[model samples]
Every structure is written in structure tokens, then in C-alpha cells.
Target chain A: MKTKSTIAIIGSTGNMGSAIAKSLAKGSNRLLLFGREDTKLQTLKNDIHTLNSGADVEAIGCPKDASWEADIVILAVPYAAEAAVAEEIRPYVTQKIVISIANPMNETFDGMVTPADSSAAQELQKLLPDAQVVKAFNTTYAANFAEPVIAGVPADAYVAGDDEKAVQTVTELVQSMGLNPVVAGGLAVSHTLEHMQLLLIQLTVKNNYNWHAGWKILHN
Target chain B: MFSELEKNLRQHITLTTDEFDRVKRYFVPKKLRRKQFMLEASDVCTRMAFVSKGALFSYSTSEKGSINVVQFAFESWWMADLYSFFTEEPSKLYIEALEDSELLLLKADRLQPLLADVPAMETYLRILYQNAYVALQRRLEETIGLTAEQRYLRFMERDGRLLLRVPQHMIASYLGVTPETLSRIRKQVS
Candidate 1:
């Protein structure tokens, strides 16, 4: 039996956010789509509901309201908006399973903008200090989020968080999207995932692996 | 001495008493005096060491023959020239103890069999490598992007314990700055 989780996707109008929303719509989860623009939120809500008629979905103009009702909240915004969005929902983010999928990539996408000591997820955690920030899906491209699988194999999404329950919840969410969730060491492991994104980006641009490429842990 | 290694491994995967007993059998216990080399440059790094007590560091020499610190391993930490250990190539790094240290060395030959014998060992090794890899990646970024003062401050913030234990010059080497520069940075920050 699938657990019906109430998930809020902040910045649902964006590519990564919309892709996650589209994937989650297949499940019996209640989706709270939050965006700056009400019309885009409404369109996304309608599109998601159109795909899964049973999905109880809502369009939220206020980001704070989205965090209030969601069991799991995904900050799907760009790196630039991470701090601002986190600040908006800080009051309502207490103990919320917050998933950060943003990579602090520079404008050129060739290098990272985040400082070496801190990761974007860690920065988000610092802003919403009470929220359980789990880093996931940062390694996979936004293009891959629509399906989250490649070449008949599920893409491995590394998840890192300090809280055990939050990590497990995010892991379940990743699995719900038909992707493999790997419990990467801890919240500090977000440092590695962010760097891994840069390496993947470099490889993709240089080798032309495109959106079809996804990482998998081949263990014996 | 084995307690730290056991506790660290148990955090990730639980092992039965008997399994742990067998696991300990594979590691060759070693003791190194302060400044003694566990591994030297140009040798094939056939083994990896787990520090049970005290501290050690691995470093490489520059073209001018000046040493650059690469990594440090204190209690419960693992160290090796991974490329040389895995590929049977000559090591570019030299690993030496900063203080008299106890270590549990695992040779390359025994590693695979140990993993097969105790599946939890593989999980433990995987977690260890993952941590090491992440730390290295972060350090690389810090070296490339951050200022010396920023790097020192960040290191202090993250690992204050290391700040107290590791020598100033070694920490300077890790941060890619001279000892005098690190001193100035420390003073400025303080």
C-alpha cells in the first residue's frame, strides 16, 4: 500500500519543480504547488491533476502556506532564490522534511557559486534551522526528473541529511518517483553531491551525455 | 584500540561479535614512533592503514622538493595512496606519523577476502571511501576558490579539534598557504 504524503513543491513552475510535481502526481499524494505567479501555479496544479485525477492538488501563492500543510516540502527553486524562499517559510518549517534539489552552480554552469566549506543545502538548513534539510536529486539533471530513469534502470539519487527520519522520508519520496535513493553519509555529504553535480555537468557538456545520463552505484 | 574502529563500523552496519572477531583478525596491528614513515614515496602502496591512536599525515613533494600536506588521519581515520594501492603503481605520497601512533593495516590481498567473508566489512569500507572522497572534493574546491584566511576560518569552524591537535605548519600546508601567512591569518581572525 502506498502512503499518501502531502508534498509541497516550492517553485513548481520551474523545470526541476514541475518535473518532480509530474512524477509525484502518479501517486496518491496530495500535491501543494507553490510559485511566485498564481496563474502558473494554477496551470501546474491543473496539469498534475489532469494526469492523476485522484491526486488531491492545490495551488499556493504564498510559500509559507505551502510549508504549513505539507508533510514533505521540496525546495525546487534555483540556487539564487534558495535563501529568499527559505526565509519566507522559516517560521512554518519546524521539523518539516525539506528536500533541497538545487545546485549552487555559477551563471556559466561551469563552476559552483557556493563556498567550499558550505553547500547550498547546508545554507538552506542554516536559514530554516528547524527544518530537516535533506539533499537529493542535485546530481541528476532537471531534464531527467520527468522520468528519473534511464536505459530501463532507475537513476541513483544520493540523499544526505542529519535526521534519520527525514532522510528515510526523502528516500521514500525518491523511490516513489521510480528512482533509487542512496543514503549518502550525512548532511555534510551534501558537499560531495554538489561537487559531483559539477563533475557530471562537465562530463555532460564535454562528452554530450545529455539528459539521458544518470548515475548508478554498481556494487557487487 | 579496536573499540573506535568497531564503534565507527557499527554506526553504519551492525556485526555480530563473532563477525567482528573475524574482522579484527585480518588487520595487522602496527605501531609507529613519532615522524616514522608508514608509507614512503616511490613504494607501491600495497596496504591501507586505520589509525587506532595518535595522528599521521600523507604528503607529496613539489618540484622544488618542498612538501605539501595532502591528508591527515587521526583516530578511526583511514589513510592510503589509493591509486598506488589499487593499481600496484609507485606512490607519489609519503605517509608519516606526527605522534607515536597505533594502526591496523590491511593489505590489498586480504581486503577482497575480508569483504567476502564479512559482508558488513564492504559496507564499512564503502562508507569510509565515500567520506574520504567527499572531504577531498570539498578541500579541492576550498583550495581553488577560497582565500587563505577564509579557508583557515572554515577549517576552524568545521574541525576545531584538528586546529588544536595538528601543528600550525601542517595546517598551513593543507590550506595551501605558508606558515607565516597562516599565522597572520590566525591573528587577523582571532
Candidate 2:
């Protein structure tokens, strides 16, 4: 972009978060990895540096450190922990483009646990009113994030956010990972993205398909 | 019947008159009076209903006889015990008309051929489910996460038309609140 964007990832120790971190490391961007576990964060940072030696990645122990100056922040925490995490990151959230990849799937994975009338991103946006919350990457599996390509075809990233600039920022980030970005519409559509993830999970379980299968929007 | 469905389909995908005519025959039109049950528990839900006019809803009752409204389908919306329709199992949900409603019914037997003959309809159906899946999940999350007051306010903000049409008790059930609680919330909001 205009300059090497500083990308802060909350919950970077998780599989989804780490996968996103690994994929985005290819570009000339600095990564601030936020996590509760110090050793896990250190391990992830080392792994990223090993994959791309020139990658500037640092492990941040505190959530507030992420707010210092990140151009965009990705929330990769569990759906249940979203409010707590949002509160922790609140002070630094002003004007920052926040990307949510959390799906409010129930513990049984049979269905979702969120209120049927709202979505995870909507809840997060309400909690962090100052931040621009965009929903992306929740529909695509973490396995696909490693390369964003399967069978020589690039995976698609459906992004939804109220702010056009924020959506554009995340679209570029999705592009950097070698994925195609489709602006799915305003932030309210995040509900659709989250539910789409649940449907994918159900389909995979029913068909005995592995987590690697991804969806592509085919148009004429 | 085809005109309303065509209008809804056009919002997602444009279909030529020839393709539309080919696929339209698969749907059978049906009507239900207000409070009539279209689908009952313990019966196989062999068909999915698309609301052409008026409203209907599906609900499941707890062992204690308390009901939780799972879905409400208005004009241009689809309703069925999807699991039962797909798997041919007995449905645990009850779908009843809330108003004198007309629906375009598509049986499971006809769905495959309809898709096979007009393959583009598959894409349209996918887009339809994409939107429905999202709406259902959002409603589920809101039902779980928000308070009765918050949920009622959100419903009022998003789908206030339902408030004018649906019975107060049914709306309360949908919000997972008791009728009295809904009344209190309404009073508080006003």
C-alpha cells in the first residue's frame, strides 16, 4: 500500500489467526501479534520469521500495545470472548479498520449460539462503536488461508463493512494473501457471512468433506 | 403465482422467459386460512413452501409445552422443516399460517428435475439460501445474545411490519419472552 501497513492480529496464537498471519507475511508489512500465551506467541513469531526471513513480526503481550498505531486490526478470537476482547482493545480502536473472523457457532457445532436476529460482527461493532468492523475470512476455512489457493484456483474472500475505505483496506489485505476479494455489501451482511460459515461446516460434516473445501462465486 | 416468484428470483439472478417458463411448472400453488396448520409435528415435511401472499411461521414446543418460534415467512420467503424435507424424516416443528396465506409449493421429488432441467436455477437457489442462512443465523444469535428488551427493540427497528401483523403472543415467543414481558418491554420502549 502507500506504506508498509502495520497489521495487528488479536488471538494470533489460534489456528485461524496464525494461518492469516502466515499468509499475509509474504508482503512487506509489519505484524503485531496479540495473544494471552507468551510462549505460543513467541513460537508463532519465530515460525513467521522462519517462513519469510525479511518479515517484520513482533509478539505483543498486552492488548493495548496493539492500539499504538495499527492500520488494521484483525479479531481472531472465539465468538463468546468477543465482548471481552473488544473491551480490551477499545482504547486503541478509534478509526482503525477491524476485521472479524469469529463465527458464533455453538459448542456442539450443530448450530450457532448468537442471537438469531443479529451477527457476531454487529455485536462487535456495537461494542466497539468507534472502530470500523468488517466481516471477512469467517466463511473460508483456516486451511485455505495458508495459501488461499486450492487446485490452482484462488479462493474468494467475501468482505462486508459499513465503511467503504475500511472494506477497501481489508480487500487489499485479502488480495495480498493471493485470494480474490468480493465486497459482499454493508456491515449488516456480516450476519450472512457468519451463517455461511455455519452452513459450510454443516455441509462438510454431512458430506464427510474435509475442512479444505472452499466456495467460489461462479458468474457468467 | 409465478409472477411473485419471478420477481423475487430477479432480485438475485436474471432469468430468460424461456428458462422461467421451463422451471415454473414444477411449483404447485396452495392456500391456507389464518391459524391453519400447513405442517404438523410427526409428519414428514415433503415440500417447501414459498410465501406468495400473507404470512406463516414454524415453531417447536418444549417438553413443558412452551413454544419457541424458529422462523417466520412472509411474502417472497420460503418455509419448511428443511431437515425433514431433505432427509424425509418426521418433523419436530409446526408450521402454521398467521394470516390467510398463499404459497407456491415445491415437493422434494420435483426439485432435482427442476434444477437439472434449468441448471441456472441451482445458482439462484444457492443465492436464496445464502441470504436465508444469514438471516436465520443473525436471528438465532440475537435471540441468544440480546435481552428481551434489546431483541424487541431490534425487531422493531428491523422488521416492524411483523409487529402490525403478528399476534402479540407469537411475537413474544419469537423474541423468547413471555407475553407479559413483551408488554412491559413495549411499554418501556414507548
- In candidate 1, position B187 carries an lDDT of 90
Candidate 1 DockQ category? incorrect
Span of 10 residues, lowest total lDDT, candidate 2 chain A: A62-71
Over the stretch A125-180, how does candidate 1's per-residue lDDT look in tens digits?
Answer: 88877578999888877778676768888889999999886788788878978888
**Candidate 1's DockQ:** 0.01
Error of 2 at B1 (Å): 62
- lDDT tens digits, residue span B1-190, model 1: 5888898778899999999887876765555558767777888887788888988899999999888999888898899989888889889899988988877778686788799989988888888889878998999999899888888888889888865888888898988989999989989988
TM-score of chain B of 2: 0.94
Candidate 2's TM-score reads 0.53
lDDT of 2 at A55: 96
Prediction-by-prediction clash tally: 0, 16
